[model samples]
Target chain A: MPPPLITARSLVKRFGDLVAVDGIDVDVQPGEAFGFLGPNGAGKTSTMRMIGCVSPVSSGRLEIFGLDPAHEGRAIRSRIGVVPQLDQLDQELTVMENLVIYARYFDIPRAVAQSRAVELLDFVQLADRADDKVDPLSGGQKRRVSIARSLISEPELLLLDEPTTGLDPQARHLLWDRLHQLKERGATLVLTTHYMDEAEQLCDRLVVMDGGRIVAEGSPRALITEYATREVLEMRFGRGRNEERVDDVLGVGERVEVLPDRLLVYVADGESALAELHARSVIPESALVRRSSLEDVFLRLTGRTLVD
Target chain B: MITTRILPSALLDVRSPQRLLERNAMVYRRSWMVIFSGFFEPLFYLLSIRIGLSALVGDIEVGGKLIPYDEFVAPGLMAAAAMNGAVLESTMNVFHKWRQAKLYDSILATPMSAGDIAIGEIGFAVIRGLMYSTAFIFTMLALGMVKSAWIVMSVVACALIGFAFASIGMAWTTYMRSWADFEYVPAVTLPLFLFSATFYPLSSYGSWSWVVQLSPLYHGVVLVRASNLGEWSPSLVVHAGVLVGLSVVGMAVTASRIKTLLLK
Candidate 1:
C-alpha cells in the first residue's frame, strides 16, 4: 500500500484557555482528497494550519509525508501548497509578478519560475490580466491568482481553507474544476469548507467537526448512508405555526426533526413522505423532496441549524 | 540525523534575503515616482523654510562656522527626510500590508521566516533613504552650499539614521491597532524635527542645549552637519555611537516583536 500522505495522532491545539482542536486523529492516504467539514470556530482551519506546519501543535503527533512538523516544518512546507481563507496577494505587484515572486520565495530559478507562472496563470484563466495590478482584480480573479501562486512550487500536498467561500456559483464551479484537475494529477488534497456541495463534490473522505472535536468521519456517501436516509422531505409551515409540532404533519418517515424554519422527514422515499403529509390533511406552506447529501450528515451530527 | 537535513533546507532556499531586497529595488524601478516623492518633501522644506525664511534670519553660526541659513539647514533636512522615508515605509506601509492586505501572512507561509522579512524590509528602507540623501547632496552641491567634500559622509550618516528609525517604526507597528494610532508618530516626530536643532544650531538654544542633544534626531543632525562642515570631533564619535546603539536596540526589538506577532 502507498504510504499515508498525512497522519495525525491525537493532535491538539490551544489558544490560552480555548482549545481550538481537541485530540483529533486524521489520516490521508496518497492521491486522496480529504476534507474537514465544519462551521466557523469548528477547529478545521486550526487543524489545517498544524498540518501545513505553520502553527505548532499543542500536543500529540503530526507527520506530513512521514516527516515531523516540529523539526521538519520547512521541509514539509516546501512540499506543500496552502491557500489561506483570505487572499494574500501583494497588492503592489502585478498578477504575474505575484506568481513569479512567490516562486522565488521557494528558491525556484527565475526562468523556471517565469515559465511556471505563465502556465499557472493560464490554468487559472487569468493570463490576459497577468500584468494588471492585483488590487484591481475582482474577488474571484484574486482568488484564482492566489490558488495559482500556491501551486508555484509544485507541491506534493495542497491545503485549502474555505477555498470557495465567497465566490459566486460560476466562479466556484470554475475553481472546483481546477481543483479536480489537480487531484487527477495524483496530488494529495486537504481542504476545509462549510459548503456541503463542495465537500460532497471534492472530498473522497471527510471528518465533521464541531466545538473543537470530530463528530463523524467517512466518505460523503458513507456518512449520509449512516446518519440519514436516502431521501429527505422538507416542509415549511407558516411563520405563525409551531414547527415543533411536526409529528402532527406526517407519519411516513423513520425519523423527523423540527427546525425553527422547517420540518425534515428522513425516509427511503421522499415522494411517499410528501403524499403521507397530504393524506393527513396537513398542508405545508412549502415543501420539497431531495436526495440525502452531506448537508443532512452535517445537520445530524451538529444538530439541525446553520452556524456561522 | 535526517532532521538536520530538514533544518538546513529551511535556510538554504536559493532566494536569499539579499534577493528579497533586490526585488524591492526592481519594484522601485517601476514605482520611482513614489520614491521621488520622499526626496521632494525635504527639498521643498529646504526651499520654503531655509531659502524663503532665510532672507529674514540671514546667516547662522553652526559648529562655530558662519554659514548661510539655507546651507546650515540643508543637511538637517536631508537627515530628517531620510528618517521620515524609512519610518513611513516601515510603519504605515507595513501596517497596511499586515492588517488590511494580509500580505505578510502569505509570504510567511513560504520558506521565508520573520527574521528574513524584518531584514528585507529594513534593507529596502536603507536603499531608499540612500537615494534621497544622495539626490539632496547633489542639490546642495549645485547650490554651492557644500562647504567640504566630506558631505559624502553625510549620505552614509543619513542611511544609518534611516535604519534606526525603520527598525523602531517596524517594532512599534506591531502594536498599532488602527490608522488612528499613527497620529502619534507625526505628532511626536514633528516636535523632534522642529526642536532637535534641525533648523538651528544646538548651541543657539543656550543653556537648554543639553535637552536638544538628548533627542536621537538631534544626534543624527549633528553628525550630518559636522560631516558637511568638515569639523570632525570626538563628539562625532559619540553621535555615531548613539545612532549605532539606536539601530541595534531598534533591530533587536523589531525582530522579537515581529516573531511574536507573526508566529503567534
Candidate 2:
C-alpha cells in the first residue's frame, strides 16, 4: 500500500473540562474506506472533525497529507472534503447553486464550476431539483445535495460524519449505493457511524470506540472472528424469564449473554446448538440461528450495543 | 515550474473575499424585495422630518449662518442610514446565517480562511450601505440641498461610514452567543442614533457636548454635515481618520474572532 494519507499520534480533543477525544492513535491509508465505529458520544465525530481540520487538536500530533493541520489547514482542506453530521447546505440557494457556490470557495472558475455542478447534481441524482430551493427537499434529497456540494471540489479524501444517521432505511441504502460506487471508483472515504451494518458494509478497516477511546481495531470479519463466536443462537423465553434460564444454558454454547428480552448463545454452529438445546428438552418461546456479526463483536468488545 | 504551481491558487485565495458575496447574492437574489426594503426607513424619516418636524423646529445656526432644520438633519440621517444598513447586514443578517442557517460551517470546510469570511461579510454590508446612501443622497440633491461641491464628499463619507460600521458590526457579532443577545443591538444603536447629534447640533447638548463626540456615529455625522454645509476644515481629516482607524481595528478583531469561532 502507498503511504498513509492521514496519521494521528496520541490525538486528543478537549472542550473545557470535557475530554471529547482522549489520547488515541490512528492511520488511514490512501484509497481505502476507513470508519470510526462507535455509539454516540464515543468521540467519533470529534476525531472526524480533527481530521477534517475544523477542530483544533488539543495535544499530540495530527498530520494530513504529511503536513501539520495547525499551520497547513487551508492547504490540507483544499484537497479534502467534509460532510458534517447535519446537512448544512445553503438553505436560501437552489440545489445547484449550493454546489456551484461551494466550488467558488475552492476558486474553481465559474464555467468549470457550473459544468461540474451539473454533473455532480446528476451523480447524486438531483438533476431534476437543480433549481428548487433546498428547504423543501426531503431529508434524503437534502443529504444528496450536501454530498454533491462536498464533491464539487473533487477532494482526495472525503470525511463524512454520521452521513446517514437520521435517514430511513431506504434512504440509507440509497446513500450506501452511491458511496459504494464512489469507493469502487477509488475514492478514499473516512466516515463515522454508529450503525454496525453501515460500518460492515462500507469500511475496509475500522476501530470500535467507546467513551472517547478505541477499544478494538481491525477488519470487520477479523474483528468478529477474534472477538466473537462464528454463529449466535438468539432465544427468547417468554419475556422476564430470560435471566432465570441462564444457569440451564451454561454448557450449551461457547458462552452466553443474558439480555433483558433474550438469551444470546454464542457458539460455533448455531443450528446444531439449537438442536442440542431441543434434544435436551431446553425449549424457548422462540429461537433464531444466525451468524455472529460486527454488532456482536462490538458488544463483546465494549460490553454495550453499538446503538442504544 | 515552482511559480506556475503556486501563483494561480494564491491569487484565488487573495480574491476569495468576494466569494462570500457570490454566496450571499444567490440567497438575496430571490429575496431581492427584502433587500430593497431597507432603503425606505431613512427615506421616510427624511420626508417626515423635512415636511413635518422642520415647521415645528424652525432654523438652526451652524458655521455663523442659519440653516433650515431639514438641512441640518439630512446629513445626519444619511450617516444614520449608512449605519443602519451596515449594522443590519453585519449584525442581524450575519447572526442568522452563522447560528441558525449554519452557512459558514460548510464554508469553513473549504479553502477559504476566516479573513475571507470577514472581508466578504463586511464587503456585502458596505455594498448594501452604499446603495442606501446613494438613494438618500439623490433625495437630498433633488430637494435643492447642494449649493457647494462638498456634497460629493458626503458620498465618500457615507462609504467610509459603511466600512467603519460594517467592520465594527461584524466584530461585535462574534461576541454574540444567542438570539436574545441581539437585543443589545438596538439598545446600543438606538441611543447612538438619538444622542449622537443625529437630530440636533452638539451645541444644544450643552455640558454633554463633549460626550457626544465619543460616539462613532458622531464622527460620521460631523463629516457628512461638513460636506453638506460646504464647510471643509483641516479638522475633518481627524474625523475621517477615526473611521478609517476603526475599520482597520474592527476588521482585524473580526477576522481573528471568526477564525476562533468557526475554525476551532
Best by DockQ: 2
Q: Under CAPRI classification, how is model 1 graded?
A: medium
B-chain TM-scores per prediction: 0.89, 0.91
Interface RMSD after interface superposition, each candidate: 1.6, 0.9
Per-model root-mean-square deviation over C-alphas: 4.3, 4.2
lDDT of 2 at A14: 95
Clashing pairs in 2: none
Write candidate 1's Cα lDDT for B1-264 as tens digits. Answer: 764453333222223566567556657769778876778888898879755798888988765667888888998998988888888788888888778977768877887766677777876777777778888899888888898989989987997888888878887888899999999899978888888899888778899999998888898898889889888888788888888877766666665565566655
lDDT of 1 at B51: 57
Model 2 regions lying over 4 Å from their true place: A305-308, B1-15
Report the poorest 10 consecutive residues by lDDT, candidate 2 chain A: A299-308
- Best by the lDDT measure: 2
DockQ of each: 0.50, 0.77
Q: Could you give candidate 2's per-residue lDDT for residues B1-264 as a string of tens digits?
A: 774463332222344799999888888887877775677887888899988999999998888889999988888888988888899999999999888899888888898877788889998999888778888889888987765777888889988899999999999998999989989999988999889888988999999898998888999999999988789889999999999988877887787787777766
TM-score of each: 0.90, 0.94
